[model samples]
Target: MIASVAFRNFKALRETSLILAPFNLVIGPNGSGKTSLIQAMVQLRALARLPLRELMPDDERHPEGAEITFRFQPPFDGLEASLSCVSESLCDFLQVTPLSTGGGVDDWVGLRARLLSLKSYRFNHEAIASTSALKDGGELAPDGVNLAAVLFTLRNTNPNIFECFKAELLRIQPEYDEITLIEQADHTIALGLRLAEGAEVVPSDNLAQGTLYLLAILALAFDPEPPAIVCIEEIDRGIHPRLLREIRDLLYRLSYPASTGDTRPSVQVVATTHSPYLLDLFRDHPEEVVITEKHGRTAHFTRLSDRADLAALLEDGSLGDLWFSGILGGVPDEQ
Candidate 1:
């Protein structure tokens, strides 16, 4: 997880940074770097599965422009970050820099991770761990979603850790009437949900996109060893408004302090949402609220914390109502 991120020369962002926290909500216009920022982190994780030199032009485009620097922390989780070599065609018209743009026999790319938390630990380039295949280094695997396979692999080697994580996720996924783990011929396990009428294993793909999205969120909750910051591109993409609060509460529970003598994931979630459902649910976690604005070529954060009228509106105990009250500036499009 990343506590904060600094972007240099990246799309729209020449040099900008934002402080991050668990259960983060990033709201902004279309061109804001919300997804771009999240994609930068995704690039970090994608390194494990693919060689950095393989990154294509399509890899970095979110809405528009270019990005240069990104910084994050628990000082630096030993996770990996991957990127294509700067020497590639993607940088053909690029002016380039001394640290990354210049070419050498060292022209390889892969994940690079920080060992200490950014909040407390200093930066160290050598602090990174990497595969011999790439010059870049860090913990994330290719395609980002491959994290699922990584999780499965880890669970196989660390049953206790896996069980601990699963319990926590199930706790957040309490809405499900029933859940089951099924094994496949390829030796992979899938989580199945039972609706009110019948009981059967429902494939993750078969479930609503929101379900997979929630499951992905729970993946952070299951990190056995939690991250300092976890960034998600879209928080309210495909779920029902009714379920948004459950996800928010789960995030809150995950971020809350562990019980006496009990261990929990120390994860912070940084996500983007258009749904007022999430906004209303997490409006109270002041430190976690963020609004992004896409003005001209740059994207920046806004003040969406619990303000005077907003707080009173939230007291009404209705997310839909609070949204319509203009807290986030308009009623949510429940369409």
Candidate 2:
């Protein structure tokens, strides 16, 4: 898993470094560079496949350029990749390369594939509900499309894992009696939900946004060939507050093995949330929470667990209350 990442002249993150946990939940107000942090990951992933110019187009915010350095933990302890860009708008000059050291060609190749496997999600409910063409599954689409195909594959290939996924989903949403997989005449698949034992299955297109979102997340977490790193933006969107804990747990299960019984490869998760309720869920796991605060044109990232006065802050109120009350630096400045 990526242990840490440092950014310089990258959008709002003029100079910032973030220590990542297996599961990272970044809470901050709008324009606090949360999205930029995720985008940095996306750009890093793109470098493995996309051209430098496409990845680092001239941005008015940072015409000079930017640099992103990533440091990994054990297994890849000494492996590091630094992606830098120097741009000249008039000449349209751009350069990008991964200056990795202490690893052979094979290691770099494997790391590149891992980087390419990093998936960022901002589920598009409509796209997710749309019928998916028949194809081999194991990976969920970035926008959460082709969900039915992936689920169908899981149901057929690994029934046990599918059952586990179903149980988890049902636990989060007990109202749904069962999950249905509808086969189309064109040899495609669509997802549906059964409200009662004998009730008709409601097609995904008709299902609530939260239900689809939850299913998409479960499918991703249960994926047999999961991505190396998963980034989710506004993860609490459309989900009820009470169910937020389940969502948090689900993401946690993706990272730590002790969080769940199922044996699977560790998959790092980085999620951004604007909800205090979701922030409260991570109070016990402050190491996995990062607060983003932007001042002027620069943004700073601070791990909640690194605070020197954490005990006193927790005494002030719940994690969410402190953050919402502006004691946490991530809150917006109204003065």
Candidate 3:
């Protein structure tokens, strides 16, 4: 798992570092750099897949150069690299030339796969419902457009994981008893929701937006071979406030392997949300909550647990209440 991430000269993140947990919920007002932070992680993953030159941003503000440092949990070495508009290079400690062979080359390859597996999901119901079969590896697209296809593959290859996914999904939508993949005569595949002992089957296209979003979220959360890291933007977008606690519990269970006794690697979840209900659910685990604030043009990140004063205030009220009251820094300035 990623222990921490440090950024320098990366858009709104002029200089910032965030210590991550198994499950993190980032809360911030508009344009406070919540999206920018997530985008930086996504860009790092892109660098792992594409050429560094292609991934680097063409910004002249950071003349000295930009750098992103990723610190991983033990047994795996950390990575630090210099990035620039025209060139990019890895730190000497890596012991490998950019995209070349060396002592740390194998480690780099492994890290690359881990980084590349960092999937970001932003619900797009129509795109998700229209998905066809995945080419291979059952990888869902960043926008979750291939959600149905990926879940279909999981149902066929890893029935147990699919069952777990179904159970979790049911908690979100108790009306659906089972989920099945329907293959059309055109060879395109779609997800079917079986209701009331399979009396009726609702096709993917016919499902509600919230249902589709929940399916895609649970699929990523419970996949047998889940991505190393999953970034979710506005996790509470379409869901009701009352169900936020259930979703939060499901995410907590998925974030740790020991919780589910699953042999597969644990999936780390980093999500951003504006929902006070969602923030309230994470009150007991302040360490997993990150608050983003913008000072001048730079974005700063801090875990809620790191603030002693804030922890003291939680004794009197909920985190959401404190956040909304402007005691927390993520609240928007009236100006």
Candidate 4:
């Protein structure tokens, strides 16, 4: 599990650090650096897993090596590992490389785009990939394409798990009972997601924007060995308020263990949401609610549990109104 993270000049963060918990709420308005934080993690994790040489970097001045650190604890045995790297791909195109060019600045000059992306996560450093995103030196595509590869890998190594997930899909979509991977005569493999509800599985790409959004959310959130620390943007996007608690509970169960006989890894979720209904789901446990906004470029993560009068506001059924009205004291009061 990731104990904490500190980022400097990475995307929207000029310099910020936070103590990470198992289940956190990174609530903030859009563009308040919420996605940037998660993006920073994605890039850092990618670099740690993929060698800097395989990626294409767009910058050369900052050098993608401003230094990133990770303080992490592994699962099951609680093994510890750490990693830090020059922004990957940034130096891949530097003038020194055959396909790269140098910039005016030398110190981290290669990290121009994405603001140097100087960040880190805690993990086993040597496990860092020697050439690509696969933690093991095997060839694999970047994360944008990592999902499918991951499914295939899981299928081959853990057929039981894959079969279980397939059965789950069937249970969730009784009408689309048939799901599998097929390869045409051309040797191109494809996912056949069929829906039996008189509805077609339509492949993930052909899904309605709403369905696509929900599918992506589940895909990322339901991993077997989920990330130690995770941050999600607009937790309620394309999802109905009625499903907020259900999904929240799903995510929560994914993050922490319950009384089940089977053991699973721990996952921490940090999500930003605007739905009061989402907040209301945690009424019994106030600590999960975090409210945030920007003071110019700075992000303020506030705990709503600190407010003594929140119960009354919740009683009035104006959770959203109270939040925006500054009674919860997350965002700045409008003039």
| Residue pairs in collision within model 2 | none
Candidate 3 at residue 315, lDDT? 84
The candidate that wins on TM-score is: 2
| lDDT tens digits by residue: candidate 4, 1-335 | 45555555444444556555667666556666666656655655454444334323445345444323333332211211222334531211212122123222232222322223222222111211111222321222222233334445556676776676666545544556665454436433344467777656555444444433443344444455554555666667656677666567656765665533336756667677766667667766567676665666666445567678777768876655666565665564344
Clashes per model (N, Cα, C within 3 A): 44, 0, 0, 34
Candidate 3 least-lDDT 10 residues:
87-96
> Candidate 2's residue-wise lDDT over 1-335, tens digit each?
78889877777787889988888889887888898888778877876675434344445335456777787756665566666755311112223333355333336566667778999999988988888876835578888888988898889999998999998888777777798886789889978888865687889999899888888888877787788899999999889899898888788778875658767778899998988899888778888889999777678899988888888889869999988887778987676
- Candidate 4, which ten residues in sequence have the lowest lDDT sum? 122-131
Q: The CA-based lDDT of model 1 is what?
A: 0.49
Superposed Cα deviation of residue 305, candidate 2 (Å): 1.4
**Location of the lowest summed lDDT over 10 successive residues in candidate 1:** 122-131
Give lDDT per model, in order: 0.49, 0.79, 0.73, 0.49
Runs of candidate 1 exceeding 4 Å displacement: 1-9, 14-16, 42-112, 115-178, 186-191, 194-199, 203-205, 253-265, 306-335
Instruction: Kindly list the per-residue Cα lDDT of model 1 for residues 1-335, writing each as its tens digit.
Output: 45455555566555577766655777665666677666655554443333234334666544334443333343333322323334311222211112322222232221133212211111111211111122111233322333345445546666776676566555655555554554456555454566645555565556555665565555554455555545555556566888777667655655663622336646555667677667666654655676665556666655466355656666765654554454554222233
Q: 1 or 3: which has the higher lDDT?
A: 3
RMSD, candidate 4, Å: 11.4
Cα error of candidate 4 at position 11, Å: 7.2
RMSD per prediction, one decimal? 10.8, 4.1, 4.8, 11.4
- Show where candidate 2 strays beyond 4 Å: 50-63, 87-106, 136-138
Order the candidate numbers by TM-score, best to worst.
2, 3, 4, 1
- TM-score of each candidate structure, all chains considered together: 0.57, 0.88, 0.85, 0.61
